[model samples]
Target: MPADFHRIASGRPAAGSTSFEAQVLPYLDAAYNLARWLARDDADAQDVVQEAMLRAFRYFDSFRGGDARVWLLAIVRNTFYSLRMKVPPDGMQETFDDDAHAVVDEQPTPEARMLIALDVGALQKALENLPHPLRETIVLRELEECSYKEIASITGQKIGTVMSRLARARERLRAELTRHSTEVRRHDVQ
Candidate 1:
């Protein structure tokens, strides 16, 4: 194990003694990924991740011995929510249209099917369009692969709530992907 990760596994550091790179740096990717999904913008996600790292380092003494990823993710979620409260609601809230997301079965060509499989941009756009609560649940559960208990702890919700949110989020994601696939096929045909 690398020295930085070693420190993190050892648990709570002595007061002002732990290096930020040692304890907090190990989980930066997870932090940034969660932040990115929550913030839905590169710049905002970076800002949120930076703030989360700072806050985590400052409060390193409070962390008990356990999964550092979960701890860091919890901080990131809290920071994003706090930031959300600070900003006025952007008037651009998008309502999901079941009609728009409906799947139309036009027999797609082989190339179109391949392109749809590789269309990461569309999947990301669909995720971005989801409501924050649903998006966050999906990101934590599917993207981060965190357990329901871990997600519950991070989001401060009960495990049942987390499971419910994830189910709803997955259904919505399926609908979004179907819509994107149909649109991509249509574009390819035209």
Candidate 2:
């Protein structure tokens, strides 16, 4: 569990007056998650987040804050777009396994772990295959658990557009996973 994830007695995020760092710091992992998926490289993601933080600090006064997380994420997403255009994606082929950073309690049996890996890997690859718009929408809505309104704010799309993309993304993901499972079963049968 992240040290920053603590909630107050009401089991809700604590509320307070906004200090730039204080507002942004708690959502660093969320920012990094968005960045990592956008960049598809962990190192690049970190660089994007660092640059995004700086941009946030530079423009702090403009934030007419409603939701600070959305504000920071918008900056992070834009920073990624900037990085993507300025630098070639091929410039860095380096990759890191996210499993390395994930903390697991109590090892699963080998059989269970292998099954889990297969499903997770297939879903991940399927997600990577989705078009950027669909992918981004799904990531914000599902993985980040943002509302349709929040997703629209982050992605600069209408709420209806966000919902449409999510529906399309989910259908594509389901098809991809089903195809993978069928192929695996066929291989096993042979």
Candidate 3:
């Protein structure tokens, strides 16, 4: 067996006494991915991930047996929202149409169709375009596949609020994805 596992599984220091990289580094990518998806920008995402990792390390002794993913996600979510609220708003908030979200929900799109034809790059860009609340909800619920309760706990919102944000996020994402698909097709044909 590898030396690192022997140390961690044996409840001893791994390799050195300085830090538990064996126990923590494995989850680093997951932390960064969740943060990036939530922040929707590389620079901000990296910042969140670094800060979260430091926080995690600081409180590592308190973590008992449970889902580390959720624990880490909660940290990322908190960090992202704290930073999000500090940014000055532009006028685009009016573009988020709650009625449009409701309409989209009443008529669900086929996932199979999206999976077959959707452009991955376009999907990434579309996600980046969404408002912070909508984007964060979608990232946690859909991309991260978090439960509604988990999302609520992370965001400190009611379950109903989590559901609503997720719905609106989906609607905006769908519209953006559809528009991107059309643009890509047009570009391809030209």
Compare the candidates by TM-score and give the number of the best one: 2
**TM-score to true structure, per model:** 0.74, 0.83, 0.63
Q: What is the C-alpha lDDT of each candidate?
A: 0.77, 0.79, 0.67
Tens digits of per-residue lDDT, candidate 2, 1-190, equal: 2233332112433342136657777888889999888877888989999899777765766888799899989899999988888887676444446475433435898767777777887887888888778988889888888999999999898999999999999999999999999998888843
In model 3, how large is the Cα lDDT of residue 122? Answer: 59
- Candidate 3 clashing pairs, residues 3+ apart or interchain: none
Per-candidate alpha-carbon RMSD to the true structure:
7.7, 6.8, 10.0
Model 1 spans > 4 angstroms off? 1-20, 91-118, 186-190
**How do all the candidates rank in terms of TM-score, highest first?**
2, 1, 3
Task: Check candidate 2 and list the clashing pairs.
Answer: none
Model 2's TM-score against the true structure: 0.83
List model 3 lDDT by residue over 69-166, tens digit each: 77777877777666667765441122323232222223436654443334554566677777777887788887778899888877788999999999
Pick the lDDT winner.
2
Measured by TM-score, how close is model 1 to the native structure?
0.74
